[model samples]
Target: MDSHNTLSARAVPMDTSNVQIPIITVWVVMTALAAVTVCLRFYTRHSVIHILGVEDWLILIAMVFSAGACVGSIRQTFFGLGRHIWTLSPEIMVQNGIEQFYNFLFHTMSLSFTKLSIIFLYLRIMSHGVQRIATYVLLSIVMACNVWVLIYQFIQCIPLKALWDPSVPGTCFPLAANIAAAVLHIVTDFIIFLFPIPTLLTLRIPKKQKIGLVLVFSLSFFVCLISIIRMVVLKNLDLTDVTYSLAASSYWSAVEINLAVICACLTTLKPLLARLFPKLLGTSMASGESSRPNPLPRKLQLEAPSSRGRPSRRECWRLVQVCVLPPRVR
Candidate 1:
């Protein structure tokens, strides 16, 4: 009778209804956004601009990894994710373990590539000086940190198989390692979000254009917010209630990565928008007109005027400086 009581006490009631619906929904929405943004970026870079550069390629690769991460999340949902761990069958649990390992890999790769994409975009657009040097330094740091995290992720559990098979006798890294990683990610995201601000403010563009660019670049602040939320979720991660606790992290990770991809693509869409809806973007310059000389320089074209009408030397120097500076993007 005592034994029967013990067995009954250990048993958990099953929840037959689907608890993973929300996870699936989030994944579906994220994947769709990533797809749409990637398509638009490709069209703008290759067909519209006729200049496909390194940043475009990096973003494309990041999108691929983002898709992989989305697929992993969807697979996790089918294996008792979003439900109580006690309700999972042994087979589902095993599958979940395997899927979780791959999910981390997908997440790390996606995030690394996204950062690289942003860095490459900065390198391409920024003038060669302290800003460019700073970008290169950040790129190196991001690459090293991401690679270390990826390597650590795969080797965190000894015997390798111990990652998926709890029966194996092997050591695993402490959960603190994961928390530390989350903190690092959030820190780097904050840095990346703020890195371009000083240079952006120094541009010679009109005030309206400057404000618009600032707002556009400031979209990374949302990504930083998402990273902070992910870090909070990681801090409260419950090993015993992993399936439930991990749902928050999974959702935030999906949103963060896909949103990063979307943000990276947003800046590249200006040319396309300028072509399709010039009035909306407040620019009539077609994508192909990027190479043409600006009419502003011609207006400043002042050959040596008659002695009486000649401008002051200071005014002539100012005009020369304006002519030497690169044309602003409309």
Candidate 2:
């Protein structure tokens, strides 16, 4: 009876000041940015370019997952995510655990679809050769890693009920699995960031345009930097104060996922931007050479002609142009 009274006395709530606002702010802002960017991309592809492809569809799926993650984050905040675990009521603890499971699920799905969307974009633009083979290999790795992680997340605790209700018996995988997964995520981002550099360098476009393309793709490096920072933050995570430690990591995760979606959409916005602000994009609709319509899909073959006839430099330029530029309405 004395021990029971002592335990009851120790159950006092910890001070949980200012923990919820930052999470809510980050989720709202990042999700809004992702939504706006995705909507613009859809408009560009469907209404402006009129050539919606696999990448577009994949990105849309990613957006759905991202939205789910945002919802999970919001729900987590309401469940006292920023407070000390000891401060949370029993019901809040159960709710937070459930939210975390869905949070991981949504994040895994969002990232997988986002990477696949980018790979499909590359496959569509790159010619069949070593580059294409490398892309295929990367795709296989991404699919494998994400699927494995997703499966492991659910099964980490045997007697799955223990995930939300710790009163039940269960065991979980080591934390090292999470670190390893994070490393793979960062490495893949690095590879994707570097993949397009060589091809962009060899393009026959104007030097300015080449530089612009390179800079645009280099934005992925920032995403990689964010990933590295997240890993570092995770390394320092304090399990004793999980809610506090998780605040920084959660903010970074939100920023990383939303930024990835934004970058994916940015590449597709050139045509719409050129149309809306021609001078800003250095495009003039009246200039015959500068504003030529995109080559017809049927005429834009991915492979070079057979050895029978070697194509001239001008012919090669046209092929590259067709691959890189958004299709214009004739």
Candidate 3:
């Protein structure tokens, strides 16, 4: 780099600053993620057991939404007009960009780690002999490396002041640690996503069901892609002139966390889709022959009337009664 030049030199001495990102888009998606989780609960399997059944879904959803909340606090810390535009000068923007990068880094890596746990949960459900064992081994490695990366993320700088202000007296070797952790984390994401497919492909279920499982699980691939992309952005981001600029860091960081939330919600689609579009996910207490036999069939039987075309409480009660006992007299 440009070591001794004034323009390129560190200006702030030992004042390594407090940190800061896109607050709104991230919140909106996170809210939707929470709403879906709540709605899905009513779409139970064995009703009581169904609530217990989707526990993993609930945990994954919480992990992602909570991570967004962490980044959300940064906005509070980083936002006086002076704070947001802190040192708008070009050289200082470079430093700001680096700081944001690490903030985003910690947040997204935490998210990736949590989502992998959920994905492994799915792997356990779907895998058999060898695949199941392999998945467990892979996930162990993922958790270990991710923990290492997270520690390195915020703690790598000595005296910690070297994080935002190079003028601070300290030392660190974050490059190797960061790069190794990222590489392993990315690899684990892809592997978790892939390992399930072959096992899913071999299930004794019908063709349509098999295809549905494949498609649904493949959504995790999108999450994997986002992590990989973030990895690249972060690597180059460390070099950018405006590395701490909120816009640059916030935009992609939001993408990364939002994507994690989206993936968590997707895996749980069996429940959420049932809530939003009951016709597709099938109802718990519906009356009739069109049941998919896949546990929670849609509860779309009309009971009461609607003025604007939605159901009334009476309608819901009648539908429940019908499922409770078929109206057959033989």
Score every model by TM-score: 0.82, 0.83, 0.63
Best by TM-score: 2
* lDDT digits (tens) for residues 1-330 of candidate 2: 999888887897546564778887898899899999999998876776555778889999999999999999989988867777777788888888888888878887888899899888877666647878988997898788778877877787897778778788888766777888788888888888898788878866656667877888888889899989988998888988776678888898889888998887777777677667655565322334665433323332233555656443334333333233323312
The candidate, 1 or 2, that scores higher on lDDT is 2
lDDT of each: 0.75, 0.76, 0.51
In the range 32-95, model 3's lDDT, one tens digit per residue, is 6544553443343334223233335544454555555554434433432114343455455445
Clash count per candidate: 0, 0, 12
For model 3, the local distance difference test gives: 0.51
Model 1 over residues 172-249: C-alpha lDDT tens digits?
988888888877777888888898888778856556656877898899999999988998888888889788778888
Worst 10 residues of 1 by lDDT: 321-330
lDDT for 121 (candidate 2): 81
lDDT of 1: 0.75
